[model samples]
Target: MPHIKQILCIEDDLFIGEMYRRSLTKAGFAVDLIASGDEGLKAATNKQYDLILLDVMLPEKKGTEILHALRGEGKDLVPNSRILVLTNYDQDDESKMAMQSKADGYLIKADITPRRLLEIIYSLDVQSTGAE
Candidate 1:
């Protein structure tokens, strides 16, 4: 059997977070859905996850701040985890470029369906595991 991957989804919208959680869980992934940026950051720092699905506009703290902290000071704690910026916010070029630089993948939430998200996650897993 293939190893089940763990995912951390940091999204403020409860509906969207639930959707992602249900989809990812149904697809055999263990998912932890956090609705606030502060809590999400705490979770990310406390636990090691295979992938992190981050949203931009969140309560308490912005996703960019969390990303910056993770890629900067928290890098050692999550060295092997892949951070993916999944946001619906239309950020400016500079912000987008900065996020892209730090993240393993940058995707617009509105543009991608849960199925496509799963495909992307699977692809990332394959690449990381060196599996064809």
Candidate 2:
């Protein structure tokens, strides 16, 4: 049997967080849902998660800052974890910054469905694990 993947979902909105948690859990992933960037930063930096689904706009701290910190020197707890930025923003600057911060992928929240998001997660898993 294959190992069940662990996922961290950092979303501030209660509805969005629950939606991601439900979808990911139903897909057989062990998912952790955090409502604020502050809490997410601590969890993400201390735990071992296979993937991180992050929202750019968050309370206490922004997702981009978390991404930057994780990708920066001396603070990469889950350096090999795939990070996918899920946000409503379409701003080029934010996208550029996220890409520069080494985020694996970026997707607009309004443009994604749960099924498609699951597909993306699976694809990323394959890419990271080098599995068929």
Candidate 3:
């Protein structure tokens, strides 16, 4: 497989953000890690990333809102990208919202080990875009 470059990580936790950047960078992916949905959205307007790692809860808006913005085809903003939902809450409502938003994959923070996350990333199909 080709290397994964240009990753956008939209998570609020500083420690987790750093950890995700480290993980993706170590795996040869260039990462733009941010702490809020609003920041991520701004960056998306100018930067075309290969993948977007989004969190459910964000400062300005939820990941669902961001995902909706990215879904319509005219989104000539970002690169042909896929979104990976990374959140601690996998509750029914959260899952439904994510699925509705069409997230490419869902990773429940509490249930994932680092190695397991790597496996999930690798296993994802390149064409996978949107949620669930």
Candidate 4:
């Protein structure tokens, strides 16, 4: 049986966040949507989730900054929880930084559909399981 996943979606845009939440929820994943970077960072550090959908440009803190902090010693993020950067940005400096900071993947939001996003998450599940 496929394991049910819990996902944390950190997006400042209301429309995008809700869309992801609704789609992911319908796809059989438990989704937690956090609108602000600060709240997202707090939730990420305090809880263990199966996957994280992170946005780059956010209020209070940038997603790269949050990824850096989580990958560092200060915050305790789940080691197995896949973290994917979901933003409009492409392979720019910010995306490079996120990759260097241990982001599992970086994807342009405009280029992906919700169904494809779910597929990527499932692929991450395979990669994560193999890594352990």
Candidate 5:
């Protein structure tokens, strides 16, 4: 419901992160791009974000592990953030795990463009606010 002004993108690929950062920032959202899963978890826990765009694989931790942690032990810490799993991996088990962990949405990076991602975020905002 609250305007989605802040977003955290936990992506390992620098190029993709930059692309998202540029697009999101240009669209008037403040975006934090973290390249590793460990740091991503730390940021997600320590700070509040309107939305979290999480990748599945990373150097220190997997996104699924982060989802479990957030939805499990750290649930109270990030109560309002909408977490969207954004990964190129199409593995069924991982997607199932993320959904079981209560991820708001799951997306494949290769299938999404920056513009389309922004549209999805806008739709999420609309859904939250119950606005058309």
Candidate 6:
């Protein structure tokens, strides 16, 4: 059986963060829900996660900036951690920036069903295990 170690979710919206936390946890994943991108970046730098769910707009820092900073720092948050952008922004300049920052997957919050999010999380966990 596969176990979920950790998931860092950087979303400012309280409702969304709580929802994802509850949903992912119900799917057998340990989730750390954060509200600020800066805080998320700091937490990520200090700890290792199985996956990351980031929102585009955040107070103090933007998702793209955090993602790019992590990539530049070679934080190994990619392929390993699997950064997934879960934001309201989809197919716009912000989304483009996220892609440029090396987001593994970009998901629109509105389009995300609970089941779909679980699928994405499972896929990430599977990929991580395969890589190891």
Choose the strongest candidate by lDDT: 1
Q: On lDDT, who's better, 5 or 6?
A: 5
Q: What is the TM-score of each candidate against the true structure?
A: 0.92, 0.88, 0.80, 0.86, 0.90, 0.83
True lDDT of residue 87, candidate 4: 88
Ranking by TM-score: 1, 5, 2, 4, 6, 3
On TM-score, the candidate that comes out on top is 1
TM-score of 6: 0.83
Kindly indicate the candidate among 3 and 5 with the higher TM-score.
5
**Candidate 4 ranges beyond 4 A from true positions:** 1-4, 73-76, 94-101, 130-132
Clashing pairs in 5: none
Residues 1-132, candidate 3, lDDT per residue (tens digit)?
Answer: 233467899999898889888887888778898898888888876787767888878889787777777764445344466678888865588656645457678778878866677777766643353222
**Cα lDDT of all candidates, in order?**
0.88, 0.83, 0.74, 0.83, 0.88, 0.79
Q: How does candidate 5 fare on TM-score?
A: 0.90
Q: Tell how far residue 27 is off in model 6, in angstroms.
A: 1.5
| Candidate 5 local Cα displacement, residue 76, angstroms | 4.4
Once fitted onto the true fold, the runs of candidate 1 whose alpha carbons sit more than 4 angstroms away are 1-4, 73-76
Q: How accurate is candidate 1 locally (lDDT)?
A: 0.88
lDDT of 5 by residue, 35-119 (tens): 9989999999988899999898888999888888888664545778888988887778856674546878888889999999999
Q: Given candidate 4, what's the lDDT at residue 118?
A: 87
Q: After superposition, how far is residue 83 of candidate 5 from its true place, in Å?
A: 0.5
The residue-by-residue lDDT of candidate 6 on 4-119, one tens digit each, is 56889999999989998998888777899899988999988778786788888889999878888777555544444677887776557865864656877878889978789888
Provide the lowest-lDDT 10-residue window in model 2: 94-103
Off by over 4 Å in 2: 1-4, 73-75, 94-101
User: Per-residue lDDT of 9-118 in model 2, one digit per residue for the tens?
Assistant: 99988998898899989989999999898999999988888888999899998987888778866466576587899999666885567454678898889899888999
